[model samples]
Target: MPASGPPDQGEGKRRPLTALEDGYHIVTTLGSAATVLCATAFPIWLSRVRDNARALSGQSPRYARPWLYAGWIVPVANLWVPRGIVADIHRASAPGERLPHAVNWWWGLWLAGMPSGTGLMYAVPTDHVIERAYRQVYPLLAADAAVVAAVVAGVFVVRALTAAQRRRGVDSVRARPTAEATGRA
Candidate 1:
């Protein structure tokens, strides 16, 4: 019999990744890392803000402290819990005021970006994404747009909430009677 190369390394052997493929891998890795970081950090920040809002408004917390983090991961509950948490914060911070439009926009865009074909949740491999990018880039672009819009709206929501909290805090402080006024001096 004639000598032959290893069967495993012959016709069925995998080709080396191209530079572009390597770049895609790097981008995917970075994106996953960023997602993880955000996933971990956002809950902590939200928890703190939720506490502050509750204190400022002196209203009962609509959701428990754990929900600040758990709501994002729980199925079905995630659909409304996270939004409710933010809404509660805003409502508490600015009682009798309308909820900020940015809150609704942010949540809507964020939900719109969650599809596997479009948003951060890619059900396919990187190779598939690259392939799809060539033929159907619009879905990817739309997803990116949704995420970007969500981010902008989220910033507005945070700003509105912070400003409302600040105003509430100041008002509370001002409403308190001084020791002299209360004859406690």
Candidate 2:
């Protein structure tokens, strides 16, 4: 039989959340909502860009349109498909150019962050994570660093891809009049 006094004094009883814990909960909730929003919107944006890339490069897509979203969720395939998708976009946008380094860096760091404390924070309860943090902090810190690096690399990838597509579009427009003038259009 367990004897209870104050909640924190009891072996099995739960205590009221501290202000920091409460704030953590709120922040995590908001982060989760934002993640959902981004998850939904990202695939749509990727699909549009992929179509444009295909048209610009005159090459068929490496993966079908649906893979933009599924590639992230599917097991095993997830490891490579998402990277492939981004690579395809860059390749198509700049056919003769080498692939951007940011794409590889982003994917590598993203993968490293997963299966770390950062990923565990998303998978486990907040209380459990806070408790674990007291005992082991380095893993969490490393994970966070990886995730942050991934985000920075991801931004570079987006900029590179967007710029490549813009260049391709401008080149296509410039070539159009020439083709017509040469009776090739």
Query: Could you give candidate 1's per-residue lDDT for residues 34-148 as a string of tens digits?
Result: 7778777767667766777767667778898788878887888988999999999888778899999999999999888776343245566676676566568798778768877
Supply the TM-score for candidate 2: 0.79
Off by over 4 Å in 1: 1-13, 117-124, 170-185
lDDT of each: 0.72, 0.73
Tens-digit lDDT string for candidate 2 (57-101): 788989987788889988899989999999998888788999999
Candidate number achieving the greatest TM-score relative to the actual structure: 2
The Cα error of candidate 2 at residue 58, in Å, is 1.9
Clashes within 3 Å, all models in order: 0, 0
- Which whole-number lDDT from 0 to 100 does residue 57 have in model 1? 68
Best by lDDT: 2
Position 124, candidate 1: lDDT: 64
